[model samples]
Target: MAEEKESAEAMISEIHKQITDAFDVFDHEFNKTVDVREVGTIIRSLSCCPSEGELHDLLAEIEEEEPTGYIRFEKFLPTMTKVLMERRYRPIPEDVLLQAFEVLDQEKKGHLEPEELTKYMSEEGEPFTQEEMEEMLSAAVDPDKNVILYKDYVGMMTVEDN
Candidate 1:
């Protein structure tokens, strides 16, 4: 139980670090501050999918306290930590991922060649950026077979082996 608590703390620390890094990118003047208007973009860049209303509410809270129209890192961290701890933004489910893969696996072969998967990922709805495609393909593709074992990919996506 102690170990679990420590692990959770470590995970939260990492999340905070990621948020800080994302926030820093928008802090162009090296002031550790950003315009309140950029808060939603910063949050989304951290991959926290808050609804429009939820984001508006969060911004409203920030704006109320930060009448200066800017937010500092100290203020940003706690708010983001609470949002993350709530798990309001969750990963996609395994079944949904598998069904999406099934659509791409036209012949039902349970796998797809790297080229095939790349084509679909790049050409389909909400096309992945090059870096996103590379990151995903690196994990999903099997060099030995030269194919994406999509079921395994889905497991990697949905399961936390750690």
Candidate 2:
């Protein structure tokens, strides 16, 4: 039992060490902070990589965006903690998807009409391009209902494009 505990501790320690190394490398000014570009690069290089759009979603989730888009280490910790805690990576959480959906679902219908979704994507913070929004809509929306269900939206966000 003690041996098992020791092994787990070792694994955690190793992971922490790797994170510290990356943090130091990306903190170019040694100020314990990094810009959006550095965060993007580090995230892209990580094991369970995110798509560019997903990276934007992550940045939003972290809520670390300053006027200059500089993210301090503390502000970025929650995202790192969650990612590290997951045994196997999954895409964005259902609750996060729901929150995002709610922002655009002005009617409180629990789903987004195509136009409403388009408007939201274009008008919301870190606005999506028309092409990107169209691509997401085509991939996630139900043709019959002409709306995006929460499950479908979560599934779309969670899918890791190869």
Candidate 3:
């Protein structure tokens, strides 16, 4: 509801702030003409995005927009937009993930039993399939405890953007 909306807004705002700060840093470091290699370096330093293997692809994509061999801050804006739109590159907010976890962990025992999580996600909300729930649990939950720790869930869902 309102809380979810607020959390989403806060996450978007934080991402925007991070991108703006990166722009400022780039402007100060490179005098308005950044190359593909520089873009890779800067982005790698800024966030865990555009993995090393994806750098070439990112450069190619950016070149389509800028056409020029170098990218100024103005040109960089579109690249940032593209990066933000990419789920693999985008960073979800920990607070938002925690809020969702809280919704699932009604008892607030600091961990969610697999059944509780699976039932909620597969029946109460948007309804993920049984397979999807199993996959998610296998990847993020503790097999021994048969539960998911909030910290582990947060780590799996989001990355440190700063």
TM per prediction:
0.55, 0.47, 0.44
Per-model lDDT: 0.83, 0.71, 0.70
Q: Write the per-residue lDDT of candidate 1 for residues 1-162, one digit (tens) a residue.
A: 999999999999998898889999999899989988899889877667666577888877656453787887787888888877776655567898899999989999999998898898799766778998899999999889988999988988774312
Best of the candidates, TM-score = 1
In model 1, the clashing pairs are none
Ranked candidates, highest TM-score first:
1, 2, 3
Off by over 4 Å in 1: 1-71, 159-162
In order of listing, the candidates' clash counts read 0, 0, 0
lDDT of 3 by residue, 58-109 (tens): 6666664647667676666666755764645644588988888887777879
Better of 1 and 2 by TM-score: 1
